[model samples]
Target chain A: MSGAKRGGIEVLSGNDMCVEGALAAGLSFFAGYPITPSSEIAESLSSILPRRGGCFVQMEDEIASLGAAIGASLTGRKSMTATSGPGYSLMQEHIGYAAMAEVPVVIINVMRGGPSTGLPTKAGQADVMQAAWGSHGDYRTAALCPSSVKECFETTVKAFEWAERFRIPVTVLPDEIIAHMRENVDTRCIAEAKPFDRLKPGKPPEEYEPYSYEISKEGAAIADFGRGYRFHVTGLAHDATGFPTNDPEEISRCNWRIIEKVEIARSAFTWTEKFMLEDAEILVFAYGSVARTAKDAVLRLRAAGIRAGLYRPVTIWPFPASEAREVFREARKVLVPELNAGQMAGEIEKYLTRGCDVEKINRLDGEIITPVQIMEAAKALHGRKKAQSSD
Target chain B: MAGRRLSPAIDIEKYLRKRNLPHIWCAGCGNGIVLGALLRAIARSGFRQDDVAMVSGIGCSSRLPGYVDFNTLHTTHGRAIAFATGIKLGRPDMHVIVVSGDGDATAIGGNHFIHACRRNIGITAIIVNNYIYGMTGGQVSPTTPKGSRATTAPFGNAERPFDICLLAAAAGANFAARTTAFHADKLEDLIFKGLGRKGFSVIEAITPCPTCFGRRNQNPTGVDLMNLIREQSCGIEPGGKSEAPAGIRLGVFADRDEKEFTEIYAEMAAGAGR
Candidate 1:
């Protein structure tokens, strides 16, 4: 199902750009249930994939959609699914299965206001924690946040690459603003983007072990069922041979490898972008659509000589702990503005060992954070931090 | 399931995984009988040892896939059909078979099962109906006969059980059949037909959970329950269950010649002018 990649400049929304990125990255199969803000990804792919001779299935629900994607990925197809918050909640079980079985899949969650279907048409950055902890177990997750329409396409391609390289589910996190926001994108950049392919077995079937935990050896290769290398795959805690085992040591080894594979590779994918943090006295830690407002607010603060800077995390999970310590060390205060009720600030607070006073600017009324609102919150939080430091 | 011995004439040990021997089934569990029928059917169908991929959901019958020596996949509870759908769609050349139970197929996975049937995908679903949730110690299931006793229904089940064959037939399965553990030979032959079909086929193998279901009801022995199933079930012509007197009719009920989904999908892709 290979076709000449689409390239050159085009005005595309973040959701449409994501589909372009997936197609450019060779996404072979997509199974998703329609949800607001993210529905465009499913709709675009449904028409695009069949034309390219790839598969696109709209399943009965998010759970089955992810289930189908995982099943297809077992056959070595780069499969993906997209959804908003409520659908994202239903996808957690299969996400955990993908992690446990080391099945590579991509899930796009268009952040919306929700504890349960709160706002379908509007945006919310509340699902940052859920992206990391929605599943029920001790497992590390890889997630990329795209603040712009252009980043949406690039990060999606990166999500596919990282998912295959790490053999885990990678999420492309964008909010309703970025998902719906239209902007000019140069697709020529994707031509240079190298989509990392899943590892194939180099040894004979007799010498191969599906979950050997050796990154450089036979363990690196994934075996397809129809291929000569036939092996069993289960979600239960399994040994290197890919069979269920109750032994504590084996369970620990199995669990540790999947975590370590993502953990050690953190520097390769975990990242953040900064604007004017050189001599800043105040820092705004933001992401997703809120980062856009934070950038404008930081620029306005600079005009007034407040020395404010923006620290936007393009990758949310694997929280860039050490980077946060270095970037915000000199700043007097860290202001976290998010659409949710301080979810991102809560995660940032855990790793602020440098003792910088962290303040939160949160909104839960289903409105995207504005630059003026951010400036007001920053000034207020900055005053509180100054008072606390002096006291 | 291994406590009882059958005649030495039938040798199906070659198809079983010797390492997983002394399986986890209780004595006289009818799942063993169903497993035998499946392996014999595979052998008779001439599918190579590596050709078939066995997928299963969670239940007593789901454990059968783990004991067999094929490209087996023990998936999440109630998602076997969904998982198999992907496998078939991913690699249309491979043969995908789903071995799930009545509760797995008709209750939790009912949506996936019917949708797969509706799409006419190339999959053979062998659903073993034990009347109750055998894995969870006799909880009332969607297929649990009304008036039957269960742990969750101590006074007798108040809910009506699903007639799964009719469900599959109505949902547009290319082939649908019903049999019991007593009809082991017939079950094997029926599986052969299901495996030979081009689209979604369902073989609802009605087995007895002697330990939980039979102990609560009148029939306590595995043999007794098998005889009851055989006596109660009536035969009918293929695609003709609607006209038969309705007391759980057996034999093939639907066999249509619709286009398989994956083939149709491939054909559509080929004509897409990419």
Candidate 2:
């Protein structure tokens, strides 16, 4: 571990921070493909994990990399895979398999621009919607966005904990900016952080069922692999016994449980940071690398005599819908500045009605949305709201 | 012929589900023959049923994992080797085997195939080569012979096919062999040899696909496909001179003693005083 000479925080890159987080989370296996901005993750793991009696393999492609991670997870190991945009598209089907089969695996998608091989080295938040619905069919995913190098380290460990606790795939969506940026990170504090373990069934092997949901007065429980309990897992809709079934009632029951586990655990999984929102007239909703720019824009707006604040979402998938609704009910206007062509804006519009105005400030030319652009959007929205009130 | 008659140690009937039976292969298709050989080898290896992990990617042969009773994963297309690599690395105590097709292994998964062989990880890879893509109809594959007529190659294939055994040998595999399903006993022996090898071991079983490749190539019957294998293959002795064609030689072509990848990795870690 690297540290400062004076016993303070050490300067580390976002990639190194992610490595630290994975190590702290007790990740034993890392299987991945070498894509830009994400290759450092594989490289670091290859060097560090082998020394710690852990495993690292550079898989042939992204799809297999994720599949391998799932396989490693099934055998009772904390496993993860990292990739960029095009590779993330290739991993969609297996992500669904992990969701449906309830396998605990973490996927790190360092976002880049693309519909197809668009910009490999550039940063973009275009994967926001894709992270939620990239895989086919109906299912919920736990996705986190980290703005700083420190959060990059902290959020990855959080992703592992949530995935193991819930027994589903958890995605950490960091753009190329956050993935490649270097900043001072407190490694000493992280070394003392506590990690969550997978839920283990206390019953004997014969009395246990792998996919059987035991509902107490509180909620459903997930069982850890090994320790004797055996059950079947498949890509198809399955029953509580983990056996494949096509019965409509069984399918409905299985699907709802998969969705409910995350929904019921929403309070623990959802994360957001609000700055000066109590008395703000204009609010900017942002996440990932864009959130950092939004913060600077808020400061610039405040200097320009505009009451603007930022609501940064740390978890993007559940979309922070409840918090957004609450913020919209209080603020007159909300500005969503993203790297994509209005992806997160559409998500925001879904939670707002006629009273709350949602404005989209988008850029899709493989460039980061600057603080100046967001400030301009916020100023424009504020001007329009003032004119409407005067009339 | 001199070896003892060995019965399978594991219960084959219980290990495989018969309800998924009357498999999709044509009558007398050599794939079933190859599958039998693999099951027998697994039984002979003496591994516990729960400790064996079988994985496959999409294709006709990739369906083998679904039939077996164990920790089985039916993964995405052409990625079985990669998945098996993860399993072998993550759980070194478990016996990991990958069942793949020629097109699946050499086309979409070529990079993984060569690199896995180079690493010489403790994994057994069984590739069933029927010379064409049987699942998606008779399309020309990486193992399709030059000038063979496939659905996509109506004018005969212009590209050269890869000799998988030679490729594995060049990529640093500890064990490599080629056999056809016509020689059932020989196929079983090679599979057992592969399973017993400590490093990356590859068994290329020349199988039959009568429904797609055979019907399209005008060899419509399953027996005709078997006859093709029987006529094309020749035996290669251990230390004796044998007259056999370069492409159709059957038997273990490469076997050498080397430290397996996992053990060497452990040794290096120990040397570093970890």
DockQ for every prediction shown: 0.67, 0.37
Docking quality tier of model 1: medium
Error of 2 at B165 (Å): 1.6
RMSD of candidate 2 to true structure, Å: 3.4
Which prediction has the highest lDDT against the true structure?
1
Query: Best candidate, DockQ-wise?
Result: 1
Error of 2 at B2 (Å): 9.3
Q: Looking at candidate 1, what is the lDDT of residue A63?
A: 88
Error of 2 at B156 (Å): 4.4
Q: For candidate 1, lDDT tens digit of each residue in A1-391?
A: 1123568777778998788788778899999999997998888887789887689888888988999898899988999999999999999998998989898899999998988979889889868888999999888778989999989988899898878767889899999999999888776776776777888877787787789847531225587777776677888898887877879999999998888877777777667898898887888899988899999999998787677989888998878877877775676688888898888887777666566777788888889788998788778876787788798
> Candidate 2 lDDT, tens digit per residue, A1-391?
3212233577888877788888889898998999987889888887787778888777767887897898788777899999988999989988998888888889999998877888889888868888889998888778999999989988999999888878889899889999998888767756675787787766676666666765322333444333234344567677776655669998998888778777776776668999988888888988888889899999999999999999888998777777777877777689988888888888778777578887898877878889999999998999999899999
CA lDDT of each prediction against the hidden true structure: 0.84, 0.81
lDDT of 1 by residue, B78-98 (tens): 999888888888888888999
TM-scores of the candidates are 0.95, 0.90
- Give one digit per residue, the lDDT tens place, for model 2 in B41-71: 8877876777788878778888777676677
